[model samples]
Each structure stands twice: as C-alpha cells, then as structure tokens.
Target: MANHDQVLDASGLNCPLPILRAKKALSAMESGKILRIIATDPGSVKDFDSFAKQTGNPLLESGEEGGKFFFLIQKA
Candidate 1:
C-alpha cells in the first residue's frame, strides 16, 4: 500500500456517504497529497472510480481485503 497523507475511515457507511466524506477530505488536502479511504460499502468501488474521473484526482490504487474496500485518492 502507498503511504497516505491522511485516512478517512468510512466503514459501515453506505453509498453517497463514503463519497461525500471522501470529497470533503480531499477538499482539505493539498495538491499531490494522497488520501486513503477505507469503506465497507461495495458500491464505493464504482463511486470512487467515477469520483476520481470527474474530479481529476488520480485513483492511485484500489482493492479489497478482509471484506473491506480501500481506495487511495490523490488530490488534483
């Protein structure tokens, strides 16, 4: 896993919530910094993918482990 500047654990949260939190977290981050998001919602995979595309933030890496989904989003 890549070293992240910050982490937002959105575990147990559903769609929109995780994405919303991620957006907010990224807002406070500096450009080129990485924010690691941990979410349980399976929908987050798609959501984050779209988010990275729309926001121009690169999705550095994404995968699942121990039943939880993880995303590394870098601020644009």
Candidate 2:
C-alpha cells in the first residue's frame, strides 16, 4: 500500500457521509496524494468502490478489521 498523506475517520457515519468527507479531504490535498479512510458502514465497500471509479481516484487497498472498513485512496 502507498503511504497515506492524510487520514479521514468516517467511522459510525453511514452512506454518502464517508464518501462526502473523503471528497472534501481530497479536495484540500495535492493530486496523487493518498488518503486513508476508516468507516463503519458496511455499504462503504460499494460506496468507496464507486467513489473511486466515479472520481477516477485509485482505490489502493480496502478491507475490514475489527468491524471497521479501511480504505486507501490516491487522489486523482
């Protein structure tokens, strides 16, 4: 996995909140930077996948640990 430049905690947030915060975080970052996001929403699997696809950002890694979802996304 790439070294993340920022971390966004979306844990306990549902649906678009995670994706929305991620978008805001990425907006403030330089292109090609990586953001690590921690979310509790099970729907985040599909949400992050679609978010990356729609935004053209590369989803580097994503998995669950301790009932939480972890995602590494490189800003487009």
Candidate 3:
C-alpha cells in the first residue's frame, strides 16, 4: 500500500517516463492525497498539465527550481 502522500523523483528522465511514473503513483494513492514529482524533461511541463486536465486530477502546483521541473498533483 502506498502512503497518503508521496514524492517521485523523475529527474533526468525523458518524456512519458515522468508522466507514466506520476500516473502509477496516482493510481496507488487514495483520493485527496498529493503526489510531488520532480522531472528534468522539458516536455513534462506541458505533458503533465494536459494529463491533469484530462484526468480530472487537481494540479496543486507547477514550477521549476534548481533547473528541475516540479509538479504537485492532488488525487481526486
């Protein structure tokens, strides 16, 4: 079983890897929980934004820091 909150580090991974990992993580989480994802792929920004919109999961936050893209997704 996964914890209520989790952080997934996907830095250095390319497209689809980060999103795929996020999807898997979200699948393991309960409703209302949050998942933090760290990705280095530039495409992840747009991919995750669209994923969140399409999946109906709330995107709590998205930004870049220390040359990495970070996303906080709340499971609905």
Best model number under TM-score: 1
Measured over all alpha carbons after superposition, the RMSD of each candidate to the real structure, in angstroms, is 0.6, 1.0, 3.9
Model 3 segments beyond 4 Å from truth? 1-4
* Model 2 per-residue lDDT at 21: 94
> Over all chains combined, what TM-score does candidate 3 have?
0.92
Error of 1 at 26 (Å): 0.5
Give residue 61's error in model 3 in angstroms. Answer: 0.5
The global Cα lDDT (0 to 1) of model 3 is: 0.90
- Show where candidate 2 strays beyond 4 Å: none
Clashes by residue pair, model 2: none
lDDT of each: 0.95, 0.93, 0.90
Per-prediction count of colliding residue pairs?
Answer: 0, 0, 0
TM-scores for all predictions? 0.97, 0.94, 0.92
lDDT (0-100) at residue 27 of candidate 3?
97
Which portions of model 1 miss their true places by more than 4 Å? Answer: none
After TM-score superposition, what is the CA distance of residue 33 in candidate 2 from its true location, in Å? 0.6
